[model samples]
Target: MASIGLMGEQGVSAEAVPSLHERDLLLRRLADLAVLPPGRVTPQERALVDMVMATAVSRLDVAQRCRIAERVAQLPEGPRELTLALARDTIEVAAPVLAEAANIQGSDLVEIVRVTSMDHRLAVASRKILPPAAIDALIEYGNTDVLRRMLENRSIEISSRSMEVLVRRSASEPELHAPLLERPELNQRLALLMFWWVSSGTLRVEILNRHAVERRMMHIAIADVLEGGLAASGADEALRVALSLVHPPATIAKPQLTRLVNLATLGQREEFVMELAREARLRPETALRIVSDFGGEPLAVLAKALGLSRQEFGDLIVAVAELRSGYVPAKSDIERITAVFDAISTDRADLVLHLWDWSISGEAQFPLPAEE
Candidate 1:
């Protein structure tokens, strides 16, 4: 079949163009040489091919060069010099060999990528089993077409960091969404992160349905994954969330916080945690978690949300610390907790409080955004 693709960069150069008759003879000879045994190019064959090519002109147009490249690329020892020459030829002549020639190893792909245009880069991107170095180069320099082809090329492996970059870039390229979502590398956390940034409402819902964190699941995950997590207590976290929802602690009036603060001051830990839970609309276990945390940041934030005065906040810290052990917070710890209260805005505290209301009790005071 005739070479069927674009004609590109339609000219070649040599020190001497052989006479028409000489050119015809060399063309016939090169054709014969291209059919030689795989990996069997003799020293004699190389010498003759080189001598003739130096003077033998290619009346061969781009298509014919592509044809010659096709044939030469098939022969295991076709002619390394000739295959390389054609591979560096115009985009049309080079693309087929670059895309499908298994013999074009990683290093050769690298060199071709450096010297050729977009067609070559795209071809390199579509190859099966691309070398890590070749993938690195494509990720760095390949254009949109090349990037799309690589993302779709399931046979190729992409580095994680490169996939991360692609995920980030997809924020801008709406065209990239489908293939990116299908990628095995697009895990739940990254997909959720991307969902918030994506403009597509449909995609956002799809992501939420597929990867949404249930409240119980989230609390359990935190309990399992957090540093110094609450797992040592040996309580089932799901049951805690369940009980918090079913038999909640009674609500405490604002005046009750001062009374609870006094009880906490007297080392009555249970009364303080229970009343704090009541005031904050948290389960006793959840409230106790914040109070028991060594860093004290959660309690600080909750206190800030509850509108506790700085002095009451200090006493609350001391009372909660006495729950687990006699570990009085250091001066630096006290400073950090105080900073949390000062830095956290009221609106931020309200948001957290609302989420606690919604997630734990299935009640939201604020309406969700209207669906598009």
Candidate 2:
């Protein structure tokens, strides 16, 4: 039996003892515990300790959080398995607390997912890791929600084998199939592979046409088969499948269109230029010509190789119209080009803006039709 003491006493009833102050003291100890010098624990152990602390605290004060993140980042590569083990231990210790922290669920916390397996916990964690490619190689569990998490991982490389697995699973379980329908970027090769799965009688056509299926997927489906490098039979067949879908009206609004145009103009992806033009309902030739404005005659040479007429070649100049306005020929602008071409000819008309546009814009005929 414990005796109660007056005021501050050594022996007291449990109820009489100060509880709040003890917890307060414990918190202070924990706070101090969080800041031990780097030498106190090995880096791997330090990372483990952080995961534990991260999981334990209701809200890890900013300082502790920073320390833990720093420790984890400082870990060298090569022995990922050890680091992963520590992360797992940390997750087990603090699961409940971290599961509630909003910050832990965000992209800032993707490193946590990188260390964990695909499971219910990962599924919840992945909601914050958008665009699914985050854990493409990390996922081992086949939980649809976990697989759905893959949708957010943008870099998820779905090969034929992986796509086949997903399609089969989706057919047997419609709930699992739902997320794939929403991703517009699903490439044509994957789409064709799905069709092949259906053809082989491994997947049901009825399920393939479910209301969950997004119509825009059809466009990428064809584009992927045509453009995505894959050794597969029947490219023409895939194109036919794309044409069969009565595609919904395009949704590229003004801001998006302007953004795409800016992207096309600034970047040199002829493929992107061609695709953007196709999206805008412009001819591929027109799109090619626009990029040619900045690209100069190298692109024209490519077109010529593809069989454009010499008149088309003449149309590819960038000279400013009317010499009075502060303007110069592209040749005058390029010192290397001036040195090279100046030796061959003095006529700078080839660099004249109007003549160049005429040559490129299909206005002026070539001096000589391409040596056909």
Candidate 3:
């Protein structure tokens, strides 16, 4: 990659200044013409553009240089050399072009990001469509300020893997919770987990309700009932699950589990998990790791592995959620949870089960400490 050389190092001959001045005047006139309804620019104005490029732009003062970049940034055939130099210039000179330049390509943007200041990067964050390579660079190079700008810019597209990393980081980023919640792309399961880990603000309820509504507005009534149930129930159930270290095969039958799901009682949910851990060939503590989670994906995965019906999976979602929030799961909550359960392929669930067992005994412990 060739370097975009620093401007103004080699001064232009004094003879060029008069010609450069004329070119600047011509450019300003042409730029003014560009904003009005379509009309042909005079041939002299056209020659002025080419003539300005022929001059050493670096000899121009900062104000004059920035003016050139601002005008060119908006034009598709605006001088590439001019834009490139300005993008690498001081933040004030670069910001407008970086933020709104229609002609700038991803490669130039990435280079600018690599070499520019935070303000410049923030400008890059607002671009309408970022290439994967550029997005990757932004995620790595951006600091907290740049990241906030990027997240807030709806035009930015963060890849799935980057989102996962952001979600994990959100566990510790209290300031980021609201933005992450407002981010519609977040998977509900991860969003729920984030909500649990963050503060006990009213925003939690609002975001959760919004999440539910977005998932399926039609189910809002049931969700509201369950959410209302939380008020009636109180957070008294500090739901805890304690089970024997090991269990005999198939001791807790399907009917028992079904009844447990139906009653949606605290003890029953705990007992159901204990039996389920044994069936999934996971330790009670390890399996409880999933059940105690803030989201329903792990629970859905376990329910799928256990061969539960779709309704049973829905029950598990409602039961755990109600016990936690002291309210019924919202309509969106039910729809989201059931959808996750249905989406899990049997093969994936089984692989997850095996991996869970192997991981627990090998290099890893359950990630979130099992509170229960």
Candidate 4:
């Protein structure tokens, strides 16, 4: 292969420098050679092309380099070194190769994600299929925009660990909520945890509609154990809570429930939480979580589970909203809470309550045995 000798160190005279047409021709030739099938291009030819591009690529203008990148990106089996060179170029030059090249190895993608700009990361995130290592690197170095791109990329199969990290991030990065919720990788447990922080009524409703599963299978699986007194013996805290939901104690009397609502209305948070816990047969911590949830769906579910009338549920929503400082329940808020309460059946509400209890106890797992 003839040297382009475009490097400054070569001391080529200004008059001797290649013309724009000549430089474009060289770039086109390099791209043409790079994409040739192995059977069509010899090892010697491949090596020479790689060697020439290694030096000549730096001399091309951005448009010329991007042209080569766009062409090389479609190659079924291009030179890996050429792909890496183009992928490491400016985002304008690298975007095509990073987002579309199949020959770029997973490890190379990881390195690119680590060292590149946000634009490069965004391009990588848009790839048709991202490897796990590449996904991890993106999550580690990417900001919210990069992650949102990955979450929206339906072709990417994000690992459970990565999903967990994003779910945790979604608490503070509200921009990630919709895309993260849409990801197929999200499971019920993570969705439930995200429920407490998600502010969108549509998203909160989606979470409950999708994750508030019935516990019939669990009930069937543990029927024998409950009958045998294992739950009473404290074999498993989660199971014990599940059993409580199965054979609930006497309902909290209406007067007592009204007193709890009054406490919340008056902003007596601790007292309201404690009284609700006692009457609902819940741990104070569990009741606190339900009471603290600003979305009001969980509390609505709890209200339904306890057989509260629609009016009582509306009152609880108002009281809880007042309990949280500076938050006043709007008419729309009351209607939303009432709709949620009315939509849930008593049986499903009981199961959701049991699941919330188990989640609060720190025992929630994906694909719970019952779910499986």
Candidate 5:
């Protein structure tokens, strides 16, 4: 029965402009309708109220619109068009609904994330329940601040793909490291990949403690295959990598230990990788990962697995440091690396190395069976 026009458009008629009192009255009625029990308002009545409120909302000042948003955010069911209008408003008007509205569709939230400001995206990230698509949209468009909030939300389950994106991004934005590690969705594969660049000792320990699982079930499942010679020759590379973890050969050809150090110091990465792979009985690619890792823990594990003496381990650390230009290992860095090497026995280091082998051989999709 009434017409509402845009507030400042050229073609507005004076009669169509609602006074502030009328606008407040409309918002009050909308708020009233929002809290009504499910059946109290008929569908047609609700639609009419929604239409009136949506039109009037745009004309209201920010504070009034914000009050409506805060009110609607608490309702189990609110007018869809009105909620979306408020959600698309400025952050002050949008935050409440974006973060708490129960009836907002996942798709609508995704749309808001795509077109909204950082504050708007942050509000969406703060929601207690984020759908996968919405989570993906936030990761795709959000910055480190948004990601930190989402990763710390703990109420959401991040998909594997989103987790991968965050892990890769964390290489550059170290601020994401703690929150990302805190996510329950973070699995061993991701944690290990993150091991290369994560800077803190605590986070590094968190990764190793949570992810360095022994493949006990896999060891049992393939014990017969190995004994029967199935895995020795004809088995897939994944199986071979798995088999190595369970039963390392009695003797690996030992490279002259000093030569390994010399190659690493000279930045002859290819030769060092080749010799380390041969000595550690690992694939060359896995060896390359050890040498190329930005953190020293992987190299530490390799040294321990190869039974390097403390003096030799120290030399290897210096040599590896030489590969990265202008990079010098602090005393703390060497101490942390040494602590890691000393903490893990040779057997455990060997298992970690084989796990890397399995991961890098493109067989991580065939994940190791959960330990029984």
Candidate 6:
């Protein structure tokens, strides 16, 4: 990283003033061209300015670029060369800046991508703010690095088509594919695939360390996927990967956990739910709420959460019944009872057999604590 030296330093001051003046002239010219009629500037001069502005690193260059772009934007002709060159440069030039300069419509930018060689920088820029057509081209040919960097931009919404691109591309390289995991929203299918992939040690430790809750959920989901036969051999691998988690497992918020169990549990893993019940130690009402909330199949996720094996979950059901029979229990009590069950129920089918009967009796009734 060679320094350019300070632009306003003693020796630099004299030269800096002239640059500022030049920049001012370019800015005014740019503004003038924006409002000028279509025929005001010749195509050749407009093209020349576009090329210079696109490649310029300084504000003076951008000013000049803007002027030419404004002029060319009005022309029937487009400046494909300028846009392509701008994309090749490393400086953080913005796409909106280029679009503004040429007065070119987003549709026109799409046309440029169709005819031009897809430079990585241009592809990245287009993903940031290009029209739908250009977006299509970037998806078709953008490099993995460029696409990964593009994912960091909040501007790009994950649509089905975009998700398809990520899923298909994910198989190519794990390192480059890591950023997709950071996205807060993804299509269900894509999220599922990513969950499994990341759970197998494909993801970097830093990512798991930085995003604890996300990583835990991902680990649990991978276990569920393996158990469901989607990734048959993945269970051991997923667990092995999960063991690498540096921090304690993420805490599932009691309210959210209860809601998910009560409302979103259909077709989910029974083993996971059972494990979660043991760890959460939820009272019968809370457990039943979680189970009913889940509508069914909360077992698998629950089991993973509590770190319980299948046999232990059955005992947890029995313990839950006892706790429920006693009284409406707190979230902590539910966890304690299930933990006690996990420690004792080694392989007792009899204990396991009693679980369903207890589960049917449901969670104990309890009053909520007053809000502080």
**TM-score-superior candidate, 4 or 6:** 4
- After superposition, candidate 3 runs with Cα above 4 Å error: 1-55, 201-372
- C-alpha TM-scores of all predictions: 0.51, 0.29, 0.50, 0.80, 0.80, 0.36
lDDT of 2 by residue, 1-372 (tens): 232211122222477437744643343344333434457557776555445544454343334333333443333321233233224444443343223333332342355555554552454434433334434333344466666666544543454445545644554445544455454544433332232123222232222222123334555666546433333334553333333232333334545444443454444355556654555333455445435333232233222222323443233222111211323345533443222222221112111211222223322322212323
Per-residue lDDT of 146 in model 6: 53
lDDT of each: 0.62, 0.38, 0.59, 0.78, 0.77, 0.43
Give lDDT: candidate 6, residue 103.
40
lDDT of 6 at 64: 46
Q: At residue 210, what lDDT does model 2 achieve?
A: 27
Which should have the higher TM-score, number 2 or number 6?
A: 6
lDDT of 6 by residue, 1-372 (tens): 342222222222455678676665554444343333447568766666556544542354554443344444344444555544443333333344343344445665555555554453454443445555555655666666556665666665656667656655665555545677776655333443343234242342323223223334545655644434533436463333323231233345555544444422332344444544444543233344444421112332344454455564544343333323323345554454344344332222112212322322221221222324
lDDT of 4 by residue, 46-96 (tens): 978877786678677787677778877888777778889999999999999
Q: Rank the candidates by lDDT, best first.
A: 4, 5, 1, 3, 6, 2
RMSD of candidate 6 to the truth, in angstroms, is: 18.0
Q: Which is the better candidate, 4 or 5, if ranked by lDDT?
A: 4
lDDT of 5 by residue, 1-372 (tens): 242321222322466656745655556656567546569779888788887777778876676677778878887877888899899999889899999998899899889999999999999998999999999999989999999989889778888988877887787788999998888888766777677668787787677777765555766776666666643457486576657767642333345787877887888878888987988878997887788766688888888778887888888888877777637678888888889888877766777777667656753543332324
Rank ordering of all candidates by TM-score, starting from the highest: 4, 5, 1, 3, 6, 2
Q: What is the lDDT of candidate 2?
A: 0.38
Off by over 4 Å in 1: 1-18, 39-59, 73-78, 212-372
Candidate 5 positional error at 77, Å:
1.6
Q: Which model, 3 or 6, shows the larger lDDT?
A: 3
Candidate 3 lDDT score relative to the true structure: 0.59
Instruction: Count the clashes in each prediction.
Output: 1, 13, 8, 0, 0, 36
